[model samples]
Target: MDTDRAAAVDPIDVEVGFLTPALRSDLLERWNEPQRRYHNETHLRAVLRAVDALEADGEAFDATEVRLAAWLHAAVFDPTESENNERSAVFCERVLDPSAPVEEVARLVRLMGGHRVEVGDLNGAVLSDADLAVLGSDPETYDTYAADVRHEFAHVPGERFVAGRIVALEGLLERKSVYLTRAGRDMWEKQAHANLNRELGLLRAGAAG
Candidate 1:
């Protein structure tokens, strides 16, 4: 309920600032698609807010490129499609302002699909950390996010969902550090780990039951 439930994407949605009105509308419509739950406009706003938080924390980055990446990271979301990021990057590259450093944003959005920012790429670090901020939300918020994500993938059978979700969660846990930026790590590392472990535990219990 973060946005008006039936809010239409105005061609000038400004959510996609700098893009032509038509491209802005298209991007917003993608975020507003009925199929989405967690990856909706609300999630888009949250990630943008995280970008702002990063700036407030004094994190150095190519601000324009990072924010541009944030806006388009989930532009072509398809829970069932592994190539959504690549697709999203293509769409972004096609529509982004010619002077906006397309290659950098494309790289950030592509790597962001897995939250795997390249080491020392501060722009990527900011975008990746912003994308993962939800992982460190409080239990109530985290639970809500988890449920919304499940709903988004409701097409998957329950067992498959559990299995796929476990592999994904464990993959994140296996990472040496889930958040790359120092601020991100300082703020989210421990809590994010706890949240992932807790969810994995619940999924296992459900599988056992």
Candidate 2:
């Protein structure tokens, strides 16, 4: 079975029922905050769709773990701090039962902090690709994402913000490949590169001006 079909039918029947209602409510509340414009439920839904597409291919990812991690990954970002991933992982651990083996969740959360870890497994690759798919979206979608990201650090000075964002953009550009899945890379790699280049040009122009 292909990943898309498999992911759709494969029921992620975890005990997420315990966390679903409260978590959803909390997430919704958080989404309403202006600071969460980029990390809103809309972004979560897009990631979930990407996750489903990857799963349908019978990829080796742990569906339940990846799904949970995707939902919880940005739970604690400060918009100014570098420990957002670590803080998110810690929050997941605390919210989940101590007896429940959440090591995979923690590992995935940590992996989201940066692109340093090798995506050796199907699950890891899927999660990583989903996170990055935003960069490969249509120009309007990507532009909205860029704006939201800038809004996230509205408190920072323009130079500091642009410098930090440029560093992140360069890091992605330097990666072996931003989209790990074969399908994702095939379909989106060129577009991602183009988008990055365009953004880099804009950043340079802004800095120069």
Cα lDDT computed for each candidate against the true fold: 0.83, 0.77
Per-residue lDDT over 1-209 for candidate 1, one digit per residue giving the tens place of the 0 to 100 score: 22332233331233443656676668779999888999998898778777776776679998878877887888998888779889999988988888778998899889977776667889988898999999988888899999999999898999999999999999999988888888888888899999999999999999999
> Per-residue error at 26 for model 1, in Å?
3.0
Model 1, residue pairs in steric clash? none
Q: List the RMSD of every prediction in angstroms.
A: 5.1, 3.5
Error of 1 at 176 (Å): 1.7
Model 1 misplacement above 4 A: 1-17, 20-22
Over 93-168, each residue of candidate 2 has an lDDT whose tens digit, in order, gives 8887665457888788888887455746666778888888889888888999999988887988999889988888
TM-score for every candidate vs. truth?
0.88, 0.85
